[model samples]
Target: MANAASGMAVHDDCKLKFLELKAKRTYRFIVFKIEEKQKQVIVEKLGEPTKSYEDFTASLPADECRYAVYDFDFVTEENCQKSRIFSLPGLPTLQE
Candidate 1:
C-alpha cells in the first residue's frame, strides 16, 4: 500500500514483520527506514526478543529519521501480565 501524502510505498516485508511482532511476538523491536532510492519504506533491522530497550535505542541513527515498533511487556499493579506495542516515528531529539 502507498501513502498518498508522501507518495511512498511500504515494502511487503515491512508489513509482514509488523504482523509477526504483534501476533507472534517474533521480535522485540523492528526498525524501518525510508529508502529514497526505492521510494518505499523498508525494514532495516530486527531486534531479538532478548534485546533490551537500550539496545533498541542504540540501533537508531543519530542524525537520520526512522520508524520503529517496540514490544513492551510489563506486570501490572495487580500482577497481571501485559504487553503493548509502541510505535516510534521520526527523529527523536533531546531537549536542552
Candidate 2:
C-alpha cells in the first residue's frame, strides 16, 4: 500500500502507527464549527506549540451534527497559504 504522507510503500497496519507518529510530532490544524442558525462558522488553530486537538474537538456540540475534519498535510504549503487568504471551502489553488 502507499503511505498517506509520502506515498511510498507501507504496510496496511502502519497507517494508524504513522498517524500516531505524526500526532506526536505536532502539526498545524484548523478546526471549524458551524452555527447554521446564526450563519456563522468559527475557525481556530490547534496542535502543538499552541493548542491541542482534544480541546478543539471538545468545543463542538456533543450531539450529532454536521462537521468536517480536514488533514492539512495533504496540501502544499503554498495552497495552505492561499486558503488562509481566501477562506475557500477546500484548499486553495495557486492561481487564486
Provide the lDDT at 17 for model 1.
84
Scored against the true structure, residue 18 in model 2 reaches a CA lDDT of: 28
**Against the true structure, candidate 2 has what lDDT?**
0.37
Q: Best TM-score goes to which candidate?
A: 1
Give all candidate RMSDs, comma-separated.
6.1, 16.7
Q: What is the C-alpha lDDT of each candidate?
A: 0.83, 0.37
**Off by more than 4 A, model 2:** 1-29, 38-49, 64-96
Q: Which candidate tops lDDT?
A: 1
lDDT at residue 92 of model 1 (Cα atoms): 26
TM-score of each: 0.88, 0.27
TM-score of 2: 0.27
lDDT score, candidate 2, position 8:
30
